[model samples]
Target chain A: MSEPNIYQPFLMRIDKITEEAPLVKTFKLVFVNDEEGKKFQFKAGQFGEYSVFGEGECTLCIASPPTRPGYIECTFRQAGRVTGALAGKEEGEIIGFRGPYGNTFPLEQWQGKNLLFIAGGIALPPLRCVIWNALDLRDRFKEITVIYGARSVADLVYKQELEEWAKRGDLKILTTVDPGGETPDWKGEIGFVPAVLEKADPICENTVALVCGPPIMIKLTLPVLAKLGFSPENTFTTLENRMKCGIGKCGHCMVGKYFVCKDGPVFTLAQLNQLPPEY
Target chain B: MIIEKKLLKQDSVEKLFAKLKADGRRILAPKAQGDEIFFEQVASASEMAKDYIQTTLSPKGAVFPRVEALFRYQMEGKDVKIENNSEPQPTVIFGLRPCDAASFAILNSVFSWDYQDSQFKSRLAQTAAITVSCSRADEYCFCTSVGGSPGDTKGSDILLTRIGSGDYLAEILTEKGKAMVTLAPELFAEAPSEDKEKYLAKVPVKFDLKKLTEKLPEAFNNNELWMEQSLRCLGCGACAFVCPACVCFDIQDESKRESGVRLRCWDSCGFSLFTAHTSGHNPRPVQSQRWRQRVMHKFSYFNDRQKYLGCVGCGRCSRKCPADMNLLEHLKAIAEAR
Candidate 1:
């Protein structure tokens, strides 16, 4: 085998940063070397480690679906050191990034089946990648229902993108918040993600439910999906954990014997059930 | 032939060390400092800690470094430039014990199994281990219970036993070890026929390896007992860190502006985030559940998947554990329980 040192490192420059919400923002990155940029590859559910040089490093899932190329997106909240440093970054700034690592969402398995997307708060970013990937390949699936909500109207992310998907002729989109407020324009459901999912009454047969959000929302949604006749095999979800390394070697992101970066950032309910009940 | 205690002079050992250095091979041996011992790169035999017991840190740091570079990268206009990692140099680790050597075997199973970890594989290919047989066992050591003995050659290229004060008998177990000794044949005194019998007399534990291996299957799915056993662990990861067989790692990309390098570092299972999700869900939130996973992986799951035991029973965990949780006591409890 060739010496590992012979392989050059991967570099990416931050082109833009958009404030998705008060606590969340998305950074647009492009490779420094044009040839290396073309060689850059990643799957939908894969993530990358972004670094703030002297401060430290943090892991973020690739927020953009594989359907889109050239530019990559990483959405993160203002937490911890590196993330806080990243939050301080402005447009056209330079940062370090490597990967398109981890297993992507199982798009092949969901092809020709109905896709039910359930998301909560800012957790919608990673799921958004799948939503766009499915929509781009709309002919392959039966139906798409997106149920998303957060603390309030201001807390909802990708409102413009959601508006675009809602405008499409063949999609059902429902919006909600935990507590309704004085905002007179609010018209969607006002409850938790699980409650909203039940009210939507998605068909479980020949369908796969893709869920993401806070831990409490996920805990509440699993039973609801089972109640709606979705087998453990038919339900899927993405995972986020405090990760120091985006690879399996760093012991931070493991669930039983499975490493989230390698075995999955995306998993079916059946696989999740088999894992140790830590996350 | 066994040399009398008086005949084993320090000068003869120095000549062997000088010969190895002249051949451009690095020889590492244990060094004694008061009550603590450590493996240091050696210049001569005088630097070796032949009389010392266990070191504070396992010699694993020599093979799989505590910190290693994976790759380097730089950024330009929404693009990334990545450079691959560099390979390490070749070296032999001398005087490793059976427990430490067996840890390499356990590590090999994980690094080489599913997706071959090139970083680990490359270093392993160029390395050799020379293990010394235990003349006196420690209070914490229980290698006999975990498919290893003080004289097992599972991960050793050469097995050495002291026949007399300074005269050692070496059984060349691998081609690499044969090469190691062939480089300086004048240093090794030819072994006498009775050397094997003298070594076996030092066995400390009457372990039923077959019984322990058989009882492992019955312990699977018994979470309640595991929970009770692991209740006191503070989840500090000290046990995993000190263990010779644990091989979990974390990879990170450390960057400065336009340049960044990927790094692979050691990790432990005792942390809460070992199995946490970014979406705020944690599967092994409780200490009991995490501890169950540790035992299950070592004894049951690894065996079921890889057909290999995940522990070498170096007893470093038992020796270093502040909570005093020992794998041998726990396994014995599980095996003897009704």
Candidate 2:
């Protein structure tokens, strides 16, 4: 690891922009360096600080699979100054990017074990990086299951990826949408992620569950996993809060004693349980 | 080790000021700007405010500026060109209080510990601190409670205390301070018989430093005390910003079009965004939890990691605090708690 202060940030030209939902969009960026195509790397679940010049900076998780190098993709929602400006950007536009900051999920530790991936709403983007990495290297794991949800059918992201993964036939992909909405014309379940997890009755033995999404979804889903006999240690999740620097130095992104950017972007539920009940 | 004396009449002091300015060294002293005290570069010793409390911003800014360019860069066809930004000018900070002097010592740990930050280190190497003892303390001052005192002179090269009319007793504690005295030893006058009495009476011993340090570890596990103590704190982090010992910062890259520069800026933990994640989950969402983090990080975590207390007991946070959260009261509560 090189010294953190030696981190050099440069403008990455936006090669393409894909609208994932009404609010979420993915920006594919190629670094200013020609050699960037070969060396740009990030682990699954790690994030970066993206800047829109005069708009300031915001933390955005690298959503594209790490194995798929060259272009780094960040999926963002138009919530604040930088993200709103980033959402308004078009193809070939320039955006500032730094990092691959923070710790990533321990994928190597999960090899040969059954994996359960749970995500909700826009949270799917960061988890998708891991999901795709797992699928690409399918033989390394025993079984792969993805449980995902959104507010409505329209709120769901990566519809095309869902179709492709469903066709894979080697893994299980479960999806749900919140109540009080027009149901999609599909052959899948519809309910909150926690309720779906209880109904799906995922096997807890020899398995690890990776959960991500809104706080409400996680708050409700954790107990359901526990009820299904998954210990806190066997569960993992990625949490987000508003951030300026994606490094531990910035005072804001703390979860008790932990610096979310440094100590975790990924944490076991056992570790999460130790935190003050604020998250 | 204490140098006790009275100021010489006009000629000796004038020679001291002459040597300081003749060398092109920037000497920053405190000045009364309306209701606030601020450190400004002085051309002569006459410009220094003899009586002033802590400044609105600490002398930390003189070393680590609010905004500084790490490097300049330009974008070419496929590669970015970069240039190293050189060090700033050498400076001597005059008239720092003990709390302020001690904060620099705390800052030294953070910048030099894990990875050497040359940007801050270069400034520390070039800058020297001249501390002045406080004759009277305000409600916002608790330096003695946090391993410091009104007369604690560990961080300063040259420590001064007022003894008589138009006179100062200077203690040359370090080689850097000895160099200054060597340059102008003619400024020194013979000590008066009553100099020791004036030194003790003028600079009052305020708090028991040893008792406070002993009580800190016992206070660490008192969660109820911390919870109630931090109850009113809005968790805005204004306290940390105003504190002399709070050295946390955030590094950000600001770029325009094709190129940009990475900047380091002051940051605090009270803000919700400070710990927020991109995944729309925050571990410290409420005021209680955030407040706990502030106290625990300073008192427990930093001590565990660096073997030093994170605070210097400066009540500047309590003085400038918007919410009126008094750290002195909290410390006392922790000290007395079961």
TM-score leader = 1
lDDT of 1 by residue, B162-253 (tens): 66655666777788777767777766665566444455424456355556556765665677887888878989988887767777776655
Summed backbone clashes in each candidate are: 44, 11
How much is the lDDT of residue A163 in candidate 2? 79
Encode model 1's per-residue lDDT on A50-124: one tens digit a residue. 876545577788888778888889999887677888998887666777676678777887778999999998789
- Predictions in order: lDDT: 0.74, 0.74
**Residue B162, model 2, lDDT:** 68
lDDT of 2 by residue, B1-338 (tens): 54433344443554666787676677888877778887888877777665666777787787777777766666665445666666567788887887788777678786676446677778887788877777777767766566777777778887777666546666677777777776777776665554423453233334454454566655545667667777788777778776777777766657788767767778777777665655555666666556666767777666766677788876778888877888777666555544
Candidate 2 lDDT, A137-214, residue by residue in tens: 899998899999888877888988887888889999887787754365756677889999999898999899999988
lDDT of 2: 0.74
